[model samples]
Target: MIVRPLALCLTLLLAGAAAAGDIRIKDLVEFDGVRGNDLVGYGLVVGLNGTGDGLRNSPFTEEIMANILERLGVNVSGEQFRPRNVAAVLVTASLPPFARTGSRIDVTVSAIGDAKSLLGGTLVMTPLNAADGQIYAVAQGAVIAGGASAEGDGARVVQGVPTAGAIPAGAWVEREIAFDFAAMQQLRLALRSPDFTTAERIERAVNRAFGRSVARMEDAGTVVLDIAATGARSPAHALSRVENITVEPQRKARVVVDQRAGTIVMGADVRISRVAVSQGNLTLRIDERPLAVQPNPFSPGETVVVPRTDARLEEETGTGLAELAGGTSLSEVVAGLNALGVSPRDMIDILKSIKAAGALHAEFIVR
Candidate 1:
């Protein structure tokens, strides 16, 4: 059977049209100032199965250990010691908005020293502090490391990250952030992906939902809301009533390509202008054949080898220009590209070239 190179095939499918729908307001924007706060603390992980930090190399670990021991009424001053049962670590957690005192939150612990692993370990009492350097919560729990490590005398093996672990509901809130969510006069909805069209749509949809002009576009990224206009008891109540409102969000034409994974994604808004694309392959092959040269039977002359190389060039047949009409929709643009009949990598090159030539009518992003 003769193998023929792929030819440009114009296979346009009408069913490939972009879907039309509206998205919820909550999915499109973030509630300004109603977000989590980052909390971090320096702590220690103990009760390890001989996989802790080397006390000598990590002097801070030894110092913290001594301090902890002294706090427990066990004095070890001026004593040199080596132990592999404890590791210094950094504990982190996000203090959610409106978190009440005595509420439990999850915490993550990561080795800050030369600790081998955190499996089967327990994090000591660590005070998590926010940006203000005030302790907001305290965390203490058995560590559930995400990975495992094993070693013998010669070799060792590890899977995932053994130096980091987490404890579910490990931290208990001790202080509450002062935020009057109920006494707010106004609220702002910040777009996750800020766009003038999207923000305007959100403002309009929110106002329409409440049957009044309660929401107004502050900027391309923010929508200011009149909390009193909703006639709700609190800001939370006003938000709850309008968060489910759906609106058609606008998106600009975009083409994203991940060359490492050979993946290409085109937004539904993408379009292509009338252009002609030609794709063909030119292959060059070289083959080496060496021959041994031997002198007449038992001659004194040294044997030698002769090198021969065969080189050839071939251009694939069925190469021609394919014209893509001005595409009004994403399906048409995709059909035009699919007509090129080239591999994804080749398609990426063609896209880049088209972008460089100002032919592609979209934001070309390559990752």
Candidate 2:
């Protein structure tokens, strides 16, 4: 079991070994302003092999097609329009941290109209927008669909999502977010898990790096630090130097159990108080039998029907209450429940009952 792997974990915890406390600095904290920007755009997909949206149902698809034709000097308004080669779609992508103009990024395209499929389609150039309604990037490339579809007159088969696809490095950045990460005088480290003990550990670890107090805990969740005090020329260089320090973390005790699936999850810090538990199951079944009276042959007599029912109730009892001492080990908890001759499914019910009786000290979560 995965839990047994941690059984030997106590040796490392009890030995007070400094090597066991090592952790990646990236896993501990987040830089204050290093983030990504979201970009989205409206676009048209072409060369769909006659599996595109219906022109009548999605008028926007036809309008977009007409506009594209007009841009290319192909007049279509004077003629009847029936196109099976285009689909209306929305393109979305994320601009990475420190993205520069002309830098390419991946994009996801999903059909917004009643497009039957987007397979073998090519995207038209579309301008992506930020929350401020400003164009930030433009996307245009051959679609790499992750799905396929086939349809006949009366039957159709589809595997995977044929209406959505992805384009790798399909969008070029048209703008750059203005932020100078290397020139900051003060930088903040945000703890992923905000505990006072963990924050103090980080502060001490960073201060020990410079042989002076360069970091301080601002609150339970944040640690503020002076960049120049570390004697580094740039914030980038200082952060690159500080983010590798490792520290031991403090976690809360918790136990989570799923009722429908008969699954249990326990944290390493979870503990249980001494308690007694007994469990059993009772079942009842009912059955019905129909009785009928038959009329005499060639006689004008009415037929009558009668009903009967039988019921049985069976009770399954346990041996007796199993007692556990205070601060009993998890192995002991397993042993006591095993004595009742109940499997994990039954043991889940028993645990719920024990927790409800205030005997189980660990937090009980039901899903």
Candidate 3:
């Protein structure tokens, strides 16, 4: 059956319409020196219902427990301990820029043991620290697990990631990062995807928006903006106004192929040179049978037995060699392949062969 319209069948992929809604200058370019820091802490989740870690497999669990108790003024140095109601977890969160003490933030907790699940668990007061080993916040809250499990006798079922959970506003900030964001005079708009063309576009867009030559393309990946000269209060306010400006981002034309999934994706600009393709398959088969013969009971053949084997070969004529024509447009390329009347799986191989032949001008990616 025909799947495409006759008149509009030619493949035409083009850049979509420009984005809407003002993207804040804060989103477009970063104040050269302002960014968040990542914090991580090792902690424990308790109050589980018979699904915590096997203390034998994760001995460090006990070590941390002993340490916690010591900090809380409990002397357990000589006590033998084993608990199945607690699971060791790694707590992680990002400290946002300009965060102040008393502010709340979310944290993620993931089991670091053989715990079956972290459901109905509560994280203890765990100090989250940065790479500098200084505590910035403390996390503690009831875990809202996204996954769970069940087991009874010999049957069990599970869903989602029961070993990982998260807490909303679970951590309290105790310190502020030392940064004078409002004092900066310059900002850098880093292109998420670095391209010389895109960088120039961003530089031009920023300068045009403010009617001043405040932004300049420093390199393919970075654009430097003169915030002080842009007439804004400071770096922070300047970014707030400029980040919403729009600039077209450029990207190279590419063809992505998932070999395992037999999927092909091509960009609008992907082009191909003239080429011819041919495909065919060969098959060979063999059959073998074994039979045993026993001597007659009355025969003087000592009741000997013998074995016989037989084999045969058969061949089926393959769908003769097929040829595919080179195509200029994406639609033409697909139609040309369809002319060969081969399944998509076979078409994938043909595309690969064409790429190896240097006839496919676009990037041919095999994922």
Q: Largest lDDT belongs to which candidate?
A: 1
List of clashing residue pairs for candidate 2 = none
- TM-score per candidate, in order? 0.88, 0.82, 0.81
Q: Judge candidate 1 at residue 340 and give its lDDT.
A: 81
Q: Across residues 104-210, which tens digit of lDDT does each residue of candidate 1 receive?
A: 99999999999999999999999999999999999999999999899999999999999999999999999999888888899999888888988988888887788
Q: Give candidate 2's whole-model lDDT.
A: 0.79
Worst 10 residues of 3 by lDDT: 1-10
Better of 1 and 2 by TM-score: 1
Please provide, for model 3 over 1-367, each residue's C-alpha lDDT reduced to its tens digit, 9 standing for 90 to 100. Answer: 1222111212322222223333444455555666788999999999999899898999988889889889999999989878789999999999988889999999999999999999999999999999999999999999999897999999989999999999999999998988877767777778666789878878888888889899888899898888778998777677776777876566566677665565667665556666765565433333344455667878765543454444333333446655556665667766676777666666667767877888777777678
For model 2, the superposed segments whose C-alpha errors exceed 4 Å read 1-21, 150-155, 258-262, 284-293, 301-313, 324-351, 358-367
Superposed by TM-score, candidate 3 places the C-alpha of residue 46 at a distance from the truth, in angstroms, of 0.6
lDDT for each candidate structure: 0.86, 0.79, 0.77
Compose the digit string of candidate 2's lDDT tens values, residues 77-174. Answer: 87788888899999999988889998999999999999988899999999999888889899999998988888899999999999999999999999
Preferred candidate (TM-score higher): 2 or 3: 2
